[model samples]
Target chain A: MDHKILQTARELIEEAGYPALTVDQVAVRAGVGKAAIYRRYASKAEMAFAATMHGQWPPPLTDAGSLYEDLLALARAFHVRMATPTARQVAPALISELAGNPDLDAQFQNTFLAAEHAALAEIIERAVGRGELAGPIDPTIAHLLLLGSLAAGLYIINLTVDDTMITELATAAAAGIAALADRHHSGNPQGATQPQ
Target chain B: MDHKILQTARELIEEAGYPALTVDQVAVRAGVGKAAIYRRYASKAEMAFAATMHGQWPPPLTDAGSLYEDLLALARAFHVRMATPTARQVAPALISELAGNPDLDAQFQNTFLAAEHAALAEIIERAVGRGELAGPIDPTIAHLLLLGSLAAGLYIINLTVDDTMITELATAAAAGIAALADRHHSGNPQGATQPQ
Candidate 1:
């Protein structure tokens, strides 16, 4: 039923990309009637959204005791998540498709991007709580550095996102955050506010 | 006439996306015959690639005296290059299309990615020559951090790639590279190798 349709949709996206995914094709592939899919999703976009939601989402962030460990753990988890065969195929398609479609983009943000942002924000917040990170850390920028570096390595440079790459990225991100915190503290002592 | 056809192709991509940019439509829009376009480009991909290459690429890297200034300059330049209306539309489409099309991917690498990598590598080389960076700085990683962070900020988070964002990214990247260099130097005194 629902699980079978979703799995079939994921496979379709992996094999032929997002554009090739059609409601009819998904129904045919899943051996279900079109009416069944239409009952669950109104359109191809909805089907893709539902399929992505049903697919692998990054796991909940765990407290790794230290900021370095937390970032490393997060990076490693994200690397593994993005390294999946489905993710490798689906993510680029989604990113491109979402860029043009605002409604889909909003749905993606609400469903996926926001959760990822929150996970990274939590890691930064915990570091601040432990007094390991200084006040006024921009979690968005930190997340961007961490995940963006990984994305570039994986997508742009065509590098294998292995343990070594993840470790290096996490370490560099930690150092970058510390440096920014120090600069902010020294430059704007009174403006520095603790992470909420 | 060639320029006009290329411009029309770019407009087609911007308006209707890459898939919609067909030789027939481009000929109609550019007020040129199909044979005229065919004389230059064998297919739509070739036309799109030519148009992109004919359009703005990021400027060559310039020495800005200090590593921080050099990186900041490079980041700002890249930000401007990516912030173009055409770039905003075409880049994501190209990325998605290129992932599946190995011939286009190879052309993209040979035409664009390799040049960018070399430019960043040259910048890092100059920094090492001046003793600004330690031995064994990985330019590929450095380029990934800088451009990847920029791409995430621009594309993913939907953040405006403004001056403040560029400055912050460049600063963080500079710090990250410096930290990595120090760690590399300390941990692998004998094993440290220059950027390949």
Candidate 2:
């Protein structure tokens, strides 16, 4: 029953686009009562996310034995997930809704973004453990770079995210993050203190 | 009359958000007929952009005598423009619409994005002339880093784009682009040819 509703929702979004989707249509098409649909999902945004995005989120981070390789794996996974026909179609609508709807935004942050952050945190931790980094650096800029660059390429410039492009972007982001971490550590005398 | 219409459009978007804005409302609020509004602007999206973004774009790109300084200036200008209340409210809607609407998307690419690309080209040209870079690097990566990072920070992470943050982002982007350019040149023997 849940699967049927989600699949129906996905089809509707793919066919008519997200802005045109509604609970009434989903209820009718899925052959479920409105009460049943509402029982499972609180709103159209929630249902849309569940159907389009919630299934394959955070995209599995693996230990590739090096910072660059790890980042490459992460980038490759992200690109694959983002490049899907369903994801591409729904992204703009979801992003726009996220900007305006605080409840849905919070849900996304807590569930989707939080999981991705945890995955990244593990990768960064591994890098630190491997002596690749001096210490844990803030991942904010790195996160922005990876997600932002991919979004820009996919949505704005219509650039195809091929393997070569993904590798180059991952390389740039890895280098940028390392440089930033190096600069931050070196710039502050207090933070620069190392055990003798 | 144009000023009144634009001002009214800006007010409506800011007050009610972009999703709720209508051409009819703008016409009524501005004390003009629908035909008058249509005469000046072809669509609601066009009117919204004119009210919010068209006024202060592509943001001035000043040559600060060096690649880092120039990038910093550009980043700063972009941050200021994007941080405005009007811009913040309208951006998600505009971006969402751009994805779905071909005419508006084409106009945006031809006018706004084209201007930004031209400005960035000049910066890269000056960097090359100054011997700061080997050759022209694809601005695609650099552009993604700049604009994508900013959008992510603003819309997703709710980051505060301060001077220090802006400087760090610029520094990272400059270093990243330089490294990519260096690699591209060194890797390509044909492109690496220099006039004796």
- Using lDDT as the measure, the top candidate is 2
DockQ score for model 2: 0.35
Task: For each candidate, report its DockQ versus the true two-chain complex.
Answer: 0.38, 0.35
| lDDT comparing candidate 1 with the true structure | 0.71
DockQ of 1: 0.38
C-alpha lDDT of candidate 2 relative to the true structure? 0.73
State the fraction of real interface contacts model 1 keeps: 0.47
CAPRI tier for the interface of model 1 = acceptable
Q: Write candidate 2's Cα lDDT for A51-159 as tens digits.
A: 9877767777667887778877887877877777566656766766777777777877888777777777777778778777666666666677666677766655555
| Residue pairs with clashing backbones, model 1 | none
Which ten residues in a row are the worst by lDDT in model 1 chain B? Answer: B187-196
lDDT of 1 at B74: 80
lDDT of 1 by residue, A1-196 (tens): 9999988998888888766778899999899999999887656756775676424565877798877788888888777767655555556666566667777777767766777778778888887787876755777788788987787666544555679777677777877776677667666532211111
Query: Which stretch of 10 consecutive residues in model 1 chain A shows the poorest summed lDDT?
Result: A187-196
